[model samples]
Target: MTFQAETPKDDSARQVGSILAVDCGSVFSRAILVERVEGTYRLVACGEALTQAATGEEVLAGVRRAIQRVAEVTGRALLSERGFPIVPERADGSGVDALVATLSAPPPLRVWLVGLVEEQSLASGMRACQAPYATVCDVLSLVDPAVLDDVGGLTARLQRLRPDVVFLVGGTEEGAEGPIRRGVEALSLAALALSEEARPVLLYGGNSRLRQTVEEIAGPAYRVLAVENVRPSAERERLVPAQNALEGLYLEKASHWDPSLDLLRSWSEHPLQTTARALGHTVRYLGLQAGMDVLAVDLGACTTTVAAQRGQAFTLRSLPGLGMGAWGSGGPKPSPERLALWLPEAIAPEEVLEVAATLGAHPCTMGQVGRELLVEQALARECIARALERAGLRPGLPWDLVVGCGGFLGHLPRPSQAALILLDALQPVGVTVLAVDATFLGPALGAVASVEPLAAAQVLEQDAFLKLGTAVCLEGRGREGDLALRVRVRYENGDTLGVEVRAGTLEVIPLALGERAELELRPGRGFNLGPAHRGRTTRVYADGGVLGVVVDARGRPLSLPAEPGARRQKVQEWHWALGA
Candidate 1:
């Protein structure tokens, strides 16, 4: 619960060994070893292993193998003759240093979402769990007898799954308690079937019921904790505390099952909630060091998590059904109707679905056809929009940076395409910047941040973060072949430049850091940036980052012709504008 940096002790420092950080996700586990050399912490080596298996013992074995591999690479002999890694004598590991490990999986937590209604409150609870990296193994909402029977079935399913935790939530501020109460009773019955050692941890965040009575019913059999309701009122959400509690439970209880968990415990003087700690640390590092808001999406096979930090406040949302992996198959696939709305006129609805289905199914393939690329971008855009909306981010809010993390975006051969996917997907409305996680290391940085804030901050700025330059957009909606917009830039040095673009045009301008430009935009016919504004002028600031200035002309609802000729013409115009 308490994360503090290890301070170096003058005499005990010599006994310190090295620090190792590991992140184990659903698909992969990675380890990074940091050793003190010449009075500074230097990355010694990194290694990875597949976490294909699901059991706790399997995961632990994977962690051990990963650590041993990394140690071999570094030739550091991190493990003793008996194979146990050394623990740091000093908090800072002044001597040889110590080995600290953090594991990310075993799907340690399971939560049940309870709400007044299946669509609204239940949806909110599920979203909250998804955001903060918790899985909603089941959802219970008010329903008829048949629905109640379905809920019973779900409870049975959960008992079989044996989730380590349950998130009980329901009702807005002033709403009915009958459904939530009934759901709780069902959960209580389910808890009775779970093992005493494996008794589920329940988090109550529902309508004001008899707290004592509910606790009495569920607590003895399960570890029950209550927090503020997620939906206090119909329109308001109070999820931060409940989310915090979930993280606490994960770190305290669930982490013990991780295969490398004991090894991590031996290394870390304090407990660490691998995922939550990683996310929290990254947000803090980005906010404090960069002095800018950051949005990161980690899309996995089974779920997609979005973490955003603005100032001191942070929010994480999970979209369980939005991933491109096998687990996402049963959820809503991108509708061809929606894709038809964004595609150029030439692409047929069936064609769009073909592209979407390929990406939805294989998610790992790349170098899609130009038309397929467009459709994929459209799907990404929709997913981001829905994810952000669920996280309570209103459209038109100023977002300084958006970072994409996960296999689909991170491993892309062309970073530009990845950036384009995120830009189109999020449809960020204001002056924004973009980047990709390159390596899925946010969680690792987060874990380090919990212990050594400065180390985490340094790694984030110097090693972790990849800056995509400033993005300037004249927000608007338009159709294919429509003259979408034009932007003119006037530098402080008295240089002026102008560009005309159509819908779906992505343009990049090379600009160095510490540079500022005066930008004017003409929203053109059939497109409006903001409130019928025309030829608006604004200042654009460019930070010397990885990818420079990108001007996105992809309009909202990103209109494209449904007809072949018109769509091709529109695509041609967009390509011409970009000199493609």
Candidate 2:
């Protein structure tokens, strides 16, 4: 079959219509076909297969198979007899205009952090440095127990971590420069002690005024980069400079580290990007386009990534060892008690730990056993929570939506389960919409968004995302079991439903697909739905999904009973109430 697509009228807005994207993930390699049909970009076809790269060089085999499936299904002659993609579509339509790729295959990118204080600049630095591809080996703050302000101690720690990059961030712009200068000296001394072959690269993201002072400390032996201060002030964080530098370095190093990517580079029309980085750019683009704050997370087999954009600010944290696959050298091993906490009944902590340890080495299959599902959700909850806490976003800021990505979330047996995972982990308060990446096409779309902005926006407007309805969650506290919230939803068919949710519980109301609805939320006295609308009725337009309007009265802290039986019963009740 022969196909035709459109090009935007504006030169800058115009993008290649026929594009192919291969996302080489830790567990699976997915290939997708996007073409501008009529006037908008559409996701026409998709295919997936196991990566097997963790075991050997079989990732190439998986990529070929996935692309082949798409080509066969669409009757397209995209690949030659030898299985390589055809470059630039011929007049007969045997190839695509562009081919791009995103990869999450490497172990976490090793990083070391050195800031002025453990809680302020150090914390802000952590927020700036977190990404799915990054692993913060250690944080060396002036107050850290590990740093005694001695050159030997700093050098020893740096040597032990053997980081690929060291970030020196501290001191608000034009604020106390003494502590940051000390950090610069320590990093410089450490760089000198290590052999030239082993010395890590360094970047300074603090105190623009002291740029020359910091440079003098590095001397001629080391290269020091100065970027925007991560914590420009207590009221804000500017991370774009540091984030770009980190990814630029990672991309530079990745070309030499993996030979397989070279094959992809030669076969494709554009450079490859890290999945998380591309996703970050897309998140920023969407937030800006919609003029609202957005939060997204990608829970991978090997890593977990959380990205949020509020206006012009962006925070992305990628935590290693929180996933179902390998996290690289010296990665974290989950505490057994963490996983056991979510089980319905009492189980051996070792059983949970064993499952976690095994999953890190090998991902569990789709048809998981009961215990395995429990472990998976438990780990998922904990991982998402940890990533969020590290972000340290302001409490009063409103989040317009929360999105769940990755295999487990995308392939959830029930839409309600995915909704619950997001609700439980994020606890997004009041007037927030929830959605998934549909079929785990986030990485592919993210890569596509970079070169084809209009195409990306078109695909997003079409069906690139699956709306899972909206959530009105309470944020303030009241006595447990007290009257918490009253929700009323009116559907387009003139049908109406009202529900009362007690404090510290969850309630879900189904809104049929293709149905349009609006909601009125009234919170009880001393209970607030969000920071702005406390004890006031809030109105919002509802988005429908398999599971509709979720009224969560689980309170701000969202506690469970300390007793196992009681907690188990509570868990069952919550799950049953939502039909998850």
Candidate 3:
């Protein structure tokens, strides 16, 4: 499948000023063109097309269509007659100077983990596997009761699982090697049961002294890659080495699954990156740039990822089977009753179940502004909640900024609806800025950062995100109608607006984008804003977003009414309050 944007013309005087990025996802192929406008990088145009893999079409067919759409919208030719991106802009302003791609269309790599300790080395190894588009299908550790009883079951399970990679991690550096040697011996026995082609690649991340032994035990039949010990000591853990190794393996496996990727890979100056990793890189960059803690959530068709950065500490959790799309296919689907918890209207559980099933089979289906949309948003809330729980973020620790990425959050009918969903799902504490990737360019920006850091940074700050305003979340419970917080907003223009918020309600102050306000929050007795300002008056300066300033006094650990009618009514009221 070749993609032709326009007829080639001969002119060689055009200056290089534009960068093109494309992201291939499971459901959609998106393309964006960024050009230097008046000496600053700005988002010039964006295009999207339905990913064609579901229909037995060439994977890049979707990429071709998306890029063509960009050309059509921008009135600039981007591809040549040979169906390849024209590098170096011509005098006719046809080709892009740089082209980059981020992909999440391929399935995650299947990894089987084997380690000595369940909570130490194995835990670190599991986190490492999730760093890329790889899922830990099964874990076999010496501490497991089943393995303890029948040591031989390890080989049986290995053959049964037939994982793409066997990640073996154990022991700290200079620690005992006898147990790790035992693990290698078991893996060698497992290799005997399978043919050379069927054998899984072994990644040995254990005590450094045992590297030679591991390679010798696996011998020539198994492909063994020795990485640094994930648990170098009882008090320290290093996951970068193993995580880097897994990312390479993921790319290799993805290319194998779809040879079409090789063609896409050729267009990039740097190596192709998994969308999740690229997004993480962007998140980390934002955190470092702001010098504050940041958290980002990306809910995709097949996976839900949450990346949190606290100071120098960063944690990323990508749960494969907890996404809103491809639900019930292999990922865990939320129960109808659970989905009902976030519905603003009285939607029958059976109907929710049916819609969810349809979405699972046909992920491309989108809902209009009605019950279907509500159901989808409800599932999205559940997905984010589950992802946050998996990320293990500390409660009451204020996140400086929370960014909502992906289409489900970005393409909402109103920014208010996006705000409500984020507030409900994240339940952030204290003064936190809420933003969304309105352009769906997070992965692209991250991918481009490798080749053009300035482009990524400038585009991100100027046009990529839509600030939704600052959120002030109270952390204490109170009677439904009782006073929660007495808030006073002093705008930069010297105007003041005061409002009283009651428990179990959401309130929005009139603040426009680019506006600034100083909030004086006085919490009611037993109701605190956060750990920082418990039952006291504190002032915070907040920047404006589309929704202006939001005061969520619905209490920490937000709860819904048990009665169906009351829950529906309360949720509806919350939506109305947010102007969603």
Candidate 4:
């Protein structure tokens, strides 16, 4: 992905102008036009088309189709008379001021990790391999004698991998280097065994002292990059340098195959980023600057991306084969039975599994209804759960906010369906505001932010995010029919409504978008709204969304009846209550 500023049109760095940001996803290529109007940034037009990266068609074909759609929507002559995208604005003021792109179109970047210890540097290496486009093809350790036989076993394994990059992680700058050096020597030996063309790029992110030694061992034939140690120590990690290096390698491989990338390279000052990493960077900015911890999930057909922030630290993890689309043979595939649990009585587990496999083979947005909807929801829930678990984020009470992105969340007919799916999947507790990226602008904004921070920030604040009201999930335990929480909401108009919510049910109170209300909630003896407000009355103000303020009286660790009839009936009740 690339972002090109309008040079002839405007030279000022901070000046407000128009930008066309394109996001290339696994299944779709989307473009959103953000322009300065009346001194504020607003999304003027947006368009999408299926991504053709792996479909035997040129990737730029999909990019052009999506951009053309946006051009039509805005009634702007974004393309020149010669049919090329006009740069630096047009004489008639028809084209955009700048262009940027975020891509998730290419396959996962293959990486071979050579770390010292499984729990120390290997663990750090795993975190470094958390890039959206990264797939750890092989993790070789020097300690493993079975694989490192006296002959060529280790060399044979490395040759078979044919990885794009070899990530050497472990050891601190001031600490151990012997074990780390051995690992580097092993990599050197492996490189020597493989042909020059097949030799992987050596990225040494281990002990700082071993840099020159590693470079010498790899020789001039291997391309070596000495980045920051992923594990500065056993307890601390500095993983961004290695991750960035890996992303650069991914782009390097992509550019080699697609000449369109070379064109974009010349046009853009900032490097392209994976969709998930872009969103993760956006969330990181929000968390650090806005002072709010956030959890964001983007579900794709081929991979599931989870981005989250806790304090100043941010994490973005992508599980490639867990999505609803095709996956590589070497990666792990999600089980079909795991997706069948959320479905009703009519849809058998085996039936759901069959449909899942087919969708995995061939992904499409159409024909999604009835059993298909159930399967999608089930798959979404599983993906969300898996992402959160892998990222070590069990979003319970006190989460600042949670945002949902992707086709499933945005295209669902009812806003409540998306909200309910998030609720079921994340099971977030306490007072947490929910929102959705309706225009799929998070990744675009993220890419734009690298070039123009203000442009991306303004668009995100004014246009990209769609308010989905606030969810008040009463935490703790309660009897089935017992009152879990009682809410008294005072609207901006001075009108008040009170409701006593029983456990095991979801209640939706009507509140229009942009409407504000002050809420006073009191939970029952065992049930709690939050830690400090357990069994106590707590008051807070909130803004409304499409579905209004939803009170999920059903306690955290939400459960449904195991019996088929009861589960189906309960699910229907909740669905109807939420207007889904």
Top candidate, metric lDDT: 3
**TM-scores vs. true structure, each candidate:** 0.73, 0.84, 0.92, 0.92
RMSD of each: 6.0, 4.9, 5.2, 3.5
Between candidates 2 and 3, the one scoring higher on TM-score is 3
Worst 10 residues of 3 by lDDT: 1-10
- Lowest lDDT 10-residue stretch of candidate 1: 89-98
Tens-place lDDT per residue, model 1, 1-580, is: 1223344566454433356776656555677765545654555666766664444355655666677788677665555666565554344332224344454454435676655666666766765674355667766555654555454575577767677677777766577766666666776776676667766777787765545656877866677888877777777777677777876666565456543555556555655555545665676567656677778877654456778888777776655566654323665666776655445445777776676666656655544457666666566656766777877775555577877886666665466666656755666655677777765567776765555554554455446645656776546666644776677777768887777776667677765555666666666655555432333444445554445567767765445666757766765554443333
Backbone clashes for every candidate come to: 25, 5, 3, 1
Error of 3 at 520 (Å): 2.5
* Model 4 lDDT at residue 345: 40
Model 4 sits at a Cα RMSD from the real structure of 3.5
Model 4 residue pairs with clashes: 301-325
Our model 2 lands, by Cα RMSD against the true structure, at 4.9
lDDT for every model?
A: 0.62, 0.75, 0.82, 0.77
Q: Give per-residue CA lDDT, model 4, range 1-580, as digits (tens).
A: 2233223354464563788888767688888888878866678889998767466777777777888999888888777765566776767878777788787767778898888788888889988898667888888776665544443766777768778888888787787777767666666776787778888788889888888888887766479999988888777898889888888887778776666766655554466767887888788877777678788888777777888887776778877766656422233454664554566546765676666666666675534467777776777787778778876778463666888988768887777878988888888877878898878887888877775776777777668678888999877778888988889999999999999888889998878898999999988878887664554889988779988999998787777777767877888788778876
Model 4 stretches with alpha carbons more than 4 Å out: 1-16, 81-83, 145-151, 174-176, 326-337
| Candidate 1 lDDT score relative to the true structure | 0.62
